[model samples]
Target: MLAFKVTTVGASSGFILTKEAMAKLNVKKGDTVFLTDAPGGGFRLTPYNPDFERQMALAEDVMRADRDILRALAK
Candidate 1:
């Protein structure tokens, strides 16, 4: 399910990402893609970001869990 067409770049229109969708969205050229907006409305390109958020959430959880240790270190 890959279909991109859009054209017209000078005026602000893109979507050329071929090459097997930039190698499964690994990105290369400019590197940085994140449409995001899935769920029911549909729309999710993503070259990361979401993952960063998830990682940040996990980090926060760990920090919270070890708050006591951190406080002790601070003092």
Candidate 2:
């Protein structure tokens, strides 16, 4: 496990993640990461938001189905 020390970023405090940790998270600068409190008490960090991804996939299917209507609406 990687431990990060909380440091000051302007008025707010934050942790600086190392390059290796970022690589494991599959993220780069400005990328969004989700931090959730674990069941036991710890926390979890992840790059993927399953709900958002599923929503986007469903939206894509709808867009494909309604492409002609959407095209006319854009005018």
Candidate 3:
């Protein structure tokens, strides 16, 4: 696991990732990455996905069969 310290960025807080971590996330400078809280109470970061449309197509079928519960999740 990689450890990061919260650092100041012009009056806001941010974490700095090393070049290796950036490579693993498939992103470069100014690219958006998501940071979500883990089940164990830590944080997880990942690249913003491009295949979401395809995944949503599959989810739409499931959502239609059920209710729109899937929409409860924030995009």
Candidate 4:
């Protein structure tokens, strides 16, 4: 497990990720990472957005269902 030190960031608390952690997460400086609740009372950290994935899935469904109409509209 990787450990991080909590530090104060101008009145807010933040943690510094080590180089190894950043590499494992495949993230770089200025990149956005999300911390989400996991099963069994743990947390998950990932660079992907779950909500955006869901939204994109829904959009794909709509696009597939309306392919004929969409094709006509493109003309």
Off by over 4 Å in 2: 53-75
Worst 10 residues of 3 by lDDT: 66-75
Per-residue CA lDDT of candidate 3, range 1-75, in tens?
667799999999998989888888889999988776768899777775436756988888788876655666633
TM-score for each candidate, following the candidate numbering = 0.48, 0.63, 0.57, 0.84
- Per candidate, the number of residue pairs that clash is 0, 0, 0, 0
Between the candidate structures 1 and 4, which one is better when assessed by lDDT?
Answer: 4
Give the higher-lDDT candidate: 2 or 4.
4
RMSD of each: 10.1, 4.2, 8.8, 1.4
Assess each prediction's global lDDT (C-alpha) against the native: 0.89, 0.92, 0.78, 0.95
Order of quality (TM-score): 4, 2, 3, 1
Candidate 1 vs. true structure, TM-score: 0.48
- Top candidate by TM-score: 4
Candidates 1 and 3 compared by lDDT, better number: 1
Clashing pairs in 1: none
How many pairs of residues in model 1 come into backbone collision?
A: 0
Candidate No. with top lDDT: 4
State the lDDT of candidate 1 residue by residue for 1-75, as single tens digits.
789888899979887988998999889898888888899998889788887889999999999999999899999
Cα misplacement distance, residue 37 of candidate 1 (Å): 6.1
Question: After superposition, which runs of candidate 1 have C-alpha atoms over 4 Å from their true positions?
Answer: 1-5, 8-31, 44-48
lDDT of 3 at 6: 97
